[model samples]
Target: MSRFPILPRHQSGFAYIAAVIFLVVIAGIAVVLLRLTETQQSTVNQALLASRASLAARGGIEWVFNNPVQRCSQAPLSTSNAAPAGAVNHLTDFRAESGFLVSVSCSFRAYNEGEAIDASGNSSPVVKRIYRIDAVACNGTANTCPDTGSVPRADYVERAQVATICLLTDGAPCV
Candidate 1:
């Protein structure tokens, strides 16, 4: 029998296959990372919008408080005599400054002003006036509710309300 010499096989094909597999894995990882980044960015944007909306609401409240003559009643009285009773009363008196939008509503209700309890187990009549302000900011071009985190369709409303309390005293600050 004649001994045959063994020849080494070329590994170029193996190298190519390994490189392709590596590239595929890298691509998959990159895609996953991109998706994660997108999600994070959306969340951050929503949060920012919400914060701005809240500030706008607060601004409305401040406006109402500052302009008591227009936003609130001259005298603290019961809700029955007022135009509208309860918290839902329409204020319809507010002004929006530049870069802000505001709407204000007010109503009067009789509440005990004194902290002490009377002998009849009832508190003294304070007759406080409550004002409600609904304000919103058109931040950017997005028209979606920040809380829901979804696209808003027709008839979708994105407004925030802030209620303020004021005493019956002269020049009393809103609580």
Candidate 2:
């Protein structure tokens, strides 16, 4: 009765189903790209924070080294014990940025090396003082070095630096 043979109608709405599948795949790829971008941004931020922390720690070390007389005087050698206790100094928010804090620890030891003849032809003991310094910088609380808060944060950063210096004392107090 039909002029033209009717094709099978089982393929009805095939285009709609195909379109939905394509949309879902495209959305999934978009989500993946967004997530990857976010992760990369986080890594870059962490690296920058780390660099800031390192520079802050170096600044603390230099500060202590420059003011040896005052700092060494504060760290008195202990006679009671063979090993003296070191002195710890804190410079809260010392860096240009408000997020950074620096803490410097110093220890001093005096020892007599070999005998030396002075210009007056008098023999004198050569006294040498050794200074051990450590500087720690952190983006934690304004008053502390390491972040000791109960809640741990992914953005927290910290760096530590150390140096040792030896000075010859000519019968005077070693700074």
Candidate 3:
């Protein structure tokens, strides 16, 4: 019996299938990597926005400290209407060199002490003024003033709330 010449079975099709599978896996991995990179970039951007907001809030507090008369005046900071208690009032909007925006608000409350005997048996009633200031900074836009029931944000926007009580001791300390 004559044996047929040895012939190799066709295996070229298997190579193509293996290559396709490998390429699919590589594409999946690439997508995952791209998503991770995007998330990291977003987080960094938010952090930067927060930092700018905080700086703006601090600037508002300092402005109040510098202008004692304006802080105690009945005239509101940014409006002609009288400032009401438990209300937020706008103060200023400043632009930083880096293009960040800062906004400020101030609220004032007056407290009066009952007449009492002093160290020398003198009776007097002391009146004190307390100023609650709120400042906010935003990276790309301005935010509304914070209210009593509002929650504050940081970074893209930052809020700073401060309550300072100044005794109206003949207006010496306040001035």
Please, what are the lDDT tens digits per residue for candidate 1 over residues 1-175? 5598777976568888999999999999999999999999977866765666567666656766677545555543443335443232222222223332344455544344555457999864444555444444433233321324423542222457656566553445545
TM-score of 1: 0.59
Clashes of each: 1, 0, 3
Q: Looking at model 1, which ten-residue stretch has the lowest summed lDDT?
A: 86-95
Q: What is the C-alpha local distance difference test score of each model?
A: 0.52, 0.75, 0.59
Per-model TM-score versus the true fold: 0.59, 0.80, 0.65
How accurate locally is residue 141 in candidate 1, as Cα lDDT from 0 to 100?
31
lDDT of 3 by residue, 9-107 (tens): 875788889999999999999999999999999888877766666766677678767875465464533312334544444543455354444455566
The parts of candidate 2 lying over 4 Å away from their true place are: 1-10, 75-85, 93-98, 170-175
| CA RMSD, predictions in order | 7.8, 3.9, 6.6
Q: Which ten residues in a row have the lowest lDDT in candidate 3?
A: 147-156
The sequence of per-residue lDDT tens digits that candidate 2 reaches over residues 1-175 is: 9999999767588899999999999999999999999999999999998998888889888987786646755434322122245667787647546568888887767777788897999997776777678898887754767668711888888899988776665324444
Error of 2 at 135 (Å): 0.6
Model 1 global lDDT (CA atoms, 0 to 1): 0.52
